[model samples]
Target: MKMLRIISYAGLVAVAIMLLVAMCAILEDSVISHRAHRQELTGSTLSSPGLDHFS
Candidate 1:
């Protein structure tokens, strides 16, 4: 019984870690897309970096 409980806890922890990682990945993607959109709106170009720094 003790072994089964430990196994279940371990499985839950693994799932929690997976979900955390997936959330981070999704957040990063949205942030990147947002930055790209902002750059387009502001006409910021690669030749001059940090133009969006003020924004």
Candidate 2:
């Protein structure tokens, strides 16, 4: 019974760590995508004369 309890606790910890890692990966991807989008917008704005009228 004691061994079972220990194993269960270990499994839970492993699952928690995996979930945290997955969340970090998702967040990293989101940040990268956001930066890429911003860069593309910046590039477009720089190349377009009409956007200057809006500013």
Candidate 3:
């Protein structure tokens, strides 16, 4: 019974660590995607000549 308890605790710890790592990976991906989208939008606006006249 003691060994079973130790194993269960270890498993829970491992799962928690895995969840933390997964969350970090998702956050990094979203940040990178947002930056890319912003760059594209900026590039498009800069390339247009009439944008300054409208603003």
lDDT tens digits, residue span 8-53, model 2: 9999999999999999999889877765676687775243455333
Worst 10 residues of 1 by lDDT: 46-55
For each candidate in turn, the TM-score is 0.80, 0.78, 0.76
Best by TM-score: 1
lDDT value, candidate 2, whole model: 0.76
Candidate 1 stretches greater than 4 Å from native? 46-55
In model 2, residue pairs whose N, Cα or C atoms come closer than 3 Å (at least 3 residues apart or on different chains), thus clashing, are none
Q: After superposition, how far is residue 19 of candidate 1 from its true place, in Å?
A: 0.4
Clashing pairs counted in every model: 0, 0, 0
The C-alpha local distance difference test score for the whole of candidate 3 amounts to 0.75
lDDT of 1: 0.81
C-alpha positional error of residue 36 in candidate 2 after TM-score superposition, expressed in Å: 0.0
Task: Give lDDT tens digits, candidate 1, residues 1-55.
Answer: 9999999999999999999999999988987887888768779655245454533
Query: Which candidate has the highest lDDT of all?
Result: 1
